[model samples]
Target: MVEGEGVTARQASFGGRGARLLLRWCAVSCWLVVPIPAVVLFTTDVPWWAGVPIQALVLLLILPIGIALWFDADQHREDTGRLLRAGRPAVAEVVELELVDPGDGSADTAVLRLRISGDDVPPFEATYRGSADPEFRPGALLHATVDPADNLFVLRNLHRS
Candidate 1:
């Protein structure tokens, strides 16, 4: 029942068309998420181009987009929190699991394809890409919370520390 006890699938939110558009915006255009760091260079006392102020123009251009994204992410976080609080319990059976970075020197993580079915909740398949925990084995039944929106679910109580 405690929050974030288990490894939750962050990809659950990337279910619909919105995420694809977000990815496209970040990839094809390079307009939205890429300018955040360039804008930072202007804020520091460090000389822009050692004499030229190229960073100034870049900052002026990208600051607006950064602000917009920051506000958007903050609001989305709030909304997701609300849904998780009101979510219903469900069980997810891992149909497949694959570790993406086994020896890459990063944290143990994997992509999990799970089939979710619960009482009064329609069955659906979701691919979860996150921390690779021992609890998430193929055919393992994991606990989760089904969002009222019926599209996303958060895993819980996997390996509480």
Candidate 2:
């Protein structure tokens, strides 16, 4: 989770690539779903004056939602790339954990408060969802990375050996 500086970037509990794909699909679907029926209705039965305004209203409502999803996906992609390319390893102790039940019968998620150990790095928290790992329990040591520019943007490399 990225905090401070007025913009907080939270890493999704789910996989970042999965989230990006879902967002991209949703944005594309919005373009296909909302406008096609709208166009057909306007051309077949609606008057020009009424149809134009209605179309404009619908576009105004949905465009922002689509744009926001796309922007978020793009941001996630950029962050993931950056983290993979330039992130440095740091040992982090699990200081806290909050288990969250998604309520859909999926595995529970653990929200972690990690105290990163090293010089020039500060403690931060991140929420992760998936099957519970005993390695992530409080006081357990885990491998993680901190964004060089902002220590708050910590990325836990779950696959670390």
Candidate 3:
């Protein structure tokens, strides 16, 4: 809706695009690209004296990702702040829930069905993910805010422990 909302979201997402790129390179280094160079360098047996330079070089080449991730975080706060500042208030009722675990190292996700209604706003049902507050149960009422321009909403309370 607004030109800067995307910018705000991005900047707030990872201290902005530059930082995001840096972190992406970090994830790349940590999980993706490092193996390529690692294989190339260590494929052959090397003398004990060479191990220090090999490790140093690898660490030097691989450290940017760590720097990048230092700036990235779960970005709910940015959206939450934006919505709370100007978005319309609403209440969300938890209608149903399903927990989906990918079985990877990633966080387990909670899929929720919610019914949201507020003054001057028609009721609506939507499926939301676990970024919402953690403690909601079926039939629970939770605070929410809707960005009128986009109808994007965020649950106001922090999710569970």
Candidate 4:
């Protein structure tokens, strides 16, 4: 619980960092693998009539997956941006922190658990990931922007003064 501009926020389960990574990987793999069968069929001695249909069949199977993955990624960004722009000012307290190990194992991802305050809303818990100030430890008070339409969605703009 935090004392500041009182705002309504609810706990919502949005996709975390792992889900985003999986989506990106699926999109990229679809694109990379789709061309392989086409290239192999085209280079073979198969006639144009036989090769064309096979190539089209291969593309027909994989193109939709690629397109859907891209669309999902785009939609996620649009939704998050819309929520952030219309968010109301609020305050939250850091409850926990989880460090995510990167795929290349270069650096760790910083994830924070926060408890948001609202009059009728329960003690809402939300997680944020990205770079944060060193002072943002557990029990620290932080400013946040919560979506009025959906209290479960929030954006913590910690850099703002």
Candidate 5:
């Protein structure tokens, strides 16, 4: 095998469309995190004023942070895609997939470990962090864009189905 033999896959949890949906869900869910606490405090007579500050913090700070984090994560993935595109490596196959449990909130997304090999290339593993639906199973064919400049970038995105 070649010295730089590996595979890369696109990280697809929340693409542009998915990100929009996440934002909307976050907006709707944000109320539950703060409002519920405030209401309970007020009703239970545990100093409703104390809950006001907490609610303010959640609305003014937590919500914004969550939204920003979500966007940042999506942007990072896009940047990776661009990097792969710029590198321009040959396509590879996702020969194997091993999913590691992600302890994050996005349980729907799976963590993928790929096995790749090519002639004149040394086999290697590339771990891709992305969320695919639970329905995505092993041995699913995925197209990868490789970075010729850096063969280590065996995994990249052109398209996947």
Candidate 6:
């Protein structure tokens, strides 16, 4: 997205717990089915083909989780774009944004301290992005285009930084 003037700019937020929950769900479902096939194979002389249905069932169950993960990524990008496209053209002075990773790489996030008002005024801090920015400092202001609807997003402008 183009860095326009009014929107707030920052990095993306990571989905830490949500991703874990999905992964766990996938794991548990797979585990639950593992024994069923073993039990069927050992106890019954029924053809090995009997287990195909069980495997298919497991696959069908996990499909939604996979679909949700894809949708999640798409939604994130869309939301980020929406924030970038929201407000009037304004430049928000950048401040040091801290990033935290909750082990599951997806939850890594950055909290940027932004000067919403004037340079001398107190700045606002919000959690927005999920990655690290080596160039940003405590007082270094970055030129960002913000959307008034949500001023927390900033279209990344490498040239201005």
Q: Which candidate has the highest TM-score of all? A: 2
lDDT of 2: 0.66
- Count of clashes, each model: 2, 0, 4, 1, 9, 26
Pairs that collide in candidate 2 are: none
Cα lDDT, all candidates: 0.62, 0.66, 0.60, 0.66, 0.54, 0.53
lDDT measured at residue 38 in model 6 versus the true structure, 0 to 100: 56
- Model 6 per-residue lDDT tens digits across residues 1-161: 44333544344422345665665565566556556765776788867787678756756775565666566655555555554445333445556567777687575565666665323222344434535666565776655444444444453532232
Stretches of candidate 4 exceeding 4 Å from the true structure: 1-33, 44-65, 118-123, 131-135, 158-161
Q: Can you give the TM-score per candidate against the true fold?
A: 0.55, 0.62, 0.48, 0.53, 0.43, 0.44
Which of the numbered candidates is closest to the native, going by highest lDDT?
2
Which 10-residue window in model 2 sums to the lowest lDDT?
A: 6-15
Task: Give the C-alpha miss distance for residue 100 in model 2, angstroms.
Answer: 2.5
At residue 154, what lDDT does model 1 achieve?
68
lDDT tens readout by residue for model 2, 79-159: 777666666666777788888898999888778776664443444554544457777788888776656455534446633
- The TM-score obtained by model 6 is 0.44
Q: Which is the better candidate, 2 or 6, if ranked by TM-score?
A: 2
The regions of model 2 sitting more than 4 angstroms off are 1-22, 43-62, 102-107, 119-134, 152-154, 158-161
For candidate 6, give the lDDT.
0.53
Tell me the tens digit of each residue's lDDT in model 4 across 42-129. Answer: 7777787877787687688777898788777766665556555565566778899777777785677778888875443345667777
List the RMSD of every prediction in angstroms: 11.0, 5.4, 9.1, 7.9, 6.9, 9.9
Estimate candidate 5's alpha-carbon lDDT, on a 0 to 1 scale: 0.54
Candidate 1: residue pairs that collide = 6-157, 6-158
Give the residue spans of candidate 3 off by over 4 A.
1-78, 105-107, 131-134, 157-161
User: Model 1, stretches more than 4 Å misplaced?
Assistant: 1-76, 102-104, 157-161
